[model samples]
Target: MTGKTVGVLGFPFSKGQPKGGTELAPKELRAAGIVDRIQALGNNVIDHGDVDLSGLPADSKVGVAKNSLAVGEANKKLSEDVAKYLKKGEQVLLLGGDHSLGIGSLHGHTQVQPDTVVVWVDAHADLNTPFTSDSKNMHGMPLAYVVKEMAQFLPKTPGLEWCKPSLSTKDIVYIGLRDVDPGERKFIEQLGISCFSMHEVDKFAIKDVVEKALSQVDPSGNRPIHVSFDVDAMDPIHAASTGTKVPGGLTLREAFYIAEEIAATGRLSVLDMVEVNPKLGSPEEKEVTVANTVSVTAKFYGSKRQGDVPPNYVIPRPQA
Candidate 1:
């Protein structure tokens, strides 16, 4: 991943769920030195700023989906921005307001790199349709909107008419899932998507889980990778500020291992770092969540646990 120009885009809109502080993730992450950390890894970093989420329609629920109009419009704008940055040959790093932002990121990525494979790292399967969702939050339904196989199961959502399902089920792989819903489990089994739940992680180990996930999604190992990582995928101890954190999630080391492995692939084109809510926890918890999130993100951009030397560095020598 050296020499790559990383484009950082923030989605400061959180209409996908009933949360407020999530909209502040981009600002918080920036304040925590995310930009400097990535730049230190010897890659050129460009902060593209946050996506505009203003003046969107406040339409009522479209079927069982809540915040339909606002979520759809914001995602449309996000998709365009993502595609623009990708066209400029920069690897896109999306800092999200919530998991719902995955809808737009995936849509825009497929517009430029249709053959990209997805590695969705989250505690929840997030494959529920509007009808299947009890909360009606769009955050839990992003996968349903983007997956081609799930299209038939979706209702005609008003604001989401622009979202055409483009990704095949076979092109996606899941990691770190532990709190999957019944509907999501049905879809996973019926559609044959490769999933590495906490059960699998415990049995096969993180290294093997990652290797098998990549192999199943992109057997040729040449396709571009898009990792949609929800910080809630980590245990509540590591990420207590998220909205829907389930216990017994990935450890900090396991999370870093996954990110490091993805970075080594050299095919990571877009990454979504999401679900950090600064308002949900105490100052100490928020600090821990933000720090952990930043660390995991840096790993995906070439920071290594062993250590990293800046590009073109030379050891100090005695002066003549």
Candidate 2:
């Protein structure tokens, strides 16, 4: 088990999607005993109650980007919260409201670890800017705002001024991407971001894909890793509760292995498990999704089951 102190920041604020119940994810996950489970893993876990963005009006939408102000304000607050824990040398598990929370979670991570390597595991590239997003969803455009190369092309949204482009295209890697908009594709190709799509996963298998991904992002294997995992990255069978369901995606085993491998590196300092929407599925589906998400988080803290034998243990065989 990791010896690091873990700060669990539950961000139940979800204005990123055009739906409800996603904001309730933090509560549901907590109810499922995330804090207790992490504590059981021999790590010091602090539950920093769900972020308070209630003061921000829900009906507020600004410019071409729907809910731009609300999303921006919430992210700004979240950035401050995350930065606090990082400044104190504590690892963070940000139970996300939506994938849009990436704007804040990743930004806050960079405050302390400027050279952090982001492993963005999701179905969509999320590289759309306000000008390019046909749906005007802030979640789809988060990476565009944070990437320095695309900043000039994006218009200034209400709460985005506090956010500067902190991630160069090379500082991040994308995995489990099966869906991409035309604009997002063009931007990704032009910038030459390292992406391991579902096609690559099928061709090279997850292990090799992860190896190549890590090599691209952290060639020296020294920078801290921040894994922003969207539940939609999994196939609909495993994670049907998420809003965006791509047919072919990572299996439960593949997802867990990715998390475990990163944890083993001893450089996983931040995590964002986002986009598990309870309202989108049946009760059983919700349970499975939440359980799977929790399971992945467990792996992030070094839960390797039978393989995690006590290092100092010697078989106390009977004197035969």
Candidate 3:
């Protein structure tokens, strides 16, 4: 138990990409006992319920970006909600409909904590711009919309006008990257963002990768941390229910190690756990995915693999 109050918000939205059933993640995760599990860890848990994603504008394709209006509208609401909870002094945990929710989560977090540093744990960079992306999925372009350095490259996206670029390219570090777009690769090189792809993860190990990522992003070690974790960061075996499946990803231990290390920082202010689509896999696969996700999430809030002790306890004297 970190003695922190965690505010949980669910985004039952899937318009960021061309997928259904992602909208059901919040309900599914709750059914799996996400709130209760965190409560057992000794923190005050408040389930804020799912964000209302109704009555969005009937948006058409804006250039290459699909569902621009709906994505933007939903995220605007998400941004406001996230900022509200953070202002109340509770650490926020955002459960997603897709990675697109990152736009609002990051936007809202930076609004309250301007000096926040981001550790993006995903197999894909999610850094593509509309012009650069072939699929035109908003989920793949969340970072592009919010990163200040990429602002010049972005066109005037219609529904996203309310979102201002709040994060600098240097304020973010990437881990578990295995599949990256060519344009995204160019962006990373040109912008000089620190990236530790699976290659580095294999070479340096998860522990070193996490340490180096944190050090590179926040050398002073005092900045508030936002971990935007996509379940697809793990190998398909661990998280097979996501829309995007990139093989040869992080192992379960590696995933837990990252969460544990981040939890140890004590500066984790917001965590976005995204891309668990319940509609994508077999029944058994979905169960495994949800269970693994819940387990990993618990680690971020002080649940130890070695088992946790209650905050205070005493040794019982024999027959006292």
Candidate 4:
């Protein structure tokens, strides 16, 4: 409760990938009592509401990357907002518009603590660049944008680039990685980013992996941390509402363990729960799944909401 303040920011932009229901994620999660859920967790919760990620022109002057303007614009604002909250001493919980939102969230967090290390929890590697991503989905390209300074090949935009180009190669770690494209795989190798794939989890156990992860965070024990979590990182059996659901992800219990340990570390600052697609789930199941998500999120934040808010506060944009 003392490490950081808690702020929720919802982003409804889901066009970053091949998904439609993510735009409805915040609304569905709200109905499922996300605010009340946080309130129940005993942490101070403030919902700054969702950022406006609507109304993008059909055409982007940029080639290769789809919806570059929309994605970039929303992320720019998201980054600014996230930066604002960290400045206010709030622990940021950025609800997913999609995984691509990580670019903005990380940018904002790093703007404050440029040395912050990010623990990326997702089923996919998320290391794909526009040139290599066969899917052409911007969701898969955040890592590329953040780590590739000259890689900001936004063919059309007039230099509003906030790309970080290789966020301290030592600063990024990957856990729960099982699915990855060949190009992304090569990039990971080329960058020397640490990754504990599902295979590693099987051989070494979650606790060991987490311990190794913390060691990688900062050998000096001083850098801040940002957790970029893709809900799809969990086994799809737990919540099959994301666009990129893959098999063999972390169990619910294991996820909570990782989060709890991170919270206890005091270095945990911002957390991102991305790729929740309400449109993909059945009505009743959607409600139940979202409730679980908020619960998991609260554990990472340490406590829940207070007297004025509901149990599950909508976690939209990251900046308070």
lDDT string for model 3 (55-92, tens) is 98987545558999999999999999999999999999
Ten contiguous residues minimizing lDDT sum, candidate 1: 58-67
What TM-score goes with each of the models?
A: 0.98, 0.95, 0.97, 0.88
Q: Distance (Å) between predicted and true CA of 240, model 2?
A: 0.5
Report model 2's TM-score to 2 decimal places: 0.95
Expressed as tens digits, the lDDT of each residue in 1-320 for candidate 1 is 57899999999977888978899999999999999999989889999899988788987545559898888999999999999999999999999889889899999999999999999999999899998899999999999999999999998998899999989999999999999888999999999999999999999999999999999999999999999999999999999999998999999999999999999999999999999999999999999999999999999999999998988799999999
Q: What is the C-alpha lDDT profile of model 4 across 1-320, one tens digit per residue?
A: 43235788888878688768787777766776776566555667788888766665564455668777778788888899999988988878788788889888988888888888999999998877777788778898787777643264334332226555537667888999999999888877876888999888888999999889879767787878899988888888776878888889888877887887787787778888888888886876566568668767866766422323434578589786
User: Which segments of candidate 3 are over 4 A away from where they belong?
Assistant: 312-320
Best by lDDT: 1
Question: On TM-score, who's better, 1 or 3?
Answer: 1
Off by over 4 Å in 1: 61-63
Per-model CA lDDT versus the true structure: 0.94, 0.88, 0.93, 0.77
Q: Which 10 consecutive positions of candidate 4 have the poorest summed lDDT?
A: 150-159
Whichever of 2 and 3 has more lDDT, that candidate is 3
Location of the lowest summed lDDT over 10 successive residues in candidate 3: 307-316
Best by TM-score: 1
lDDT, residue 275, model 2: 90
Which whole-number lDDT from 0 to 100 does residue 46 have in model 2?
89
lDDT (Cα) of model 4: 0.77
Q: Which ranges in model 4 have alpha carbons more than 4 Å from their true place?
A: 2-4, 60-62, 148-160, 164-166, 303-320
Q: What is the C-alpha lDDT profile of model 2 across 11-40, one tens digit per residue?
A: 886678788878889989998888877777
Any residue pairs clashing in model 1, and if so which? none
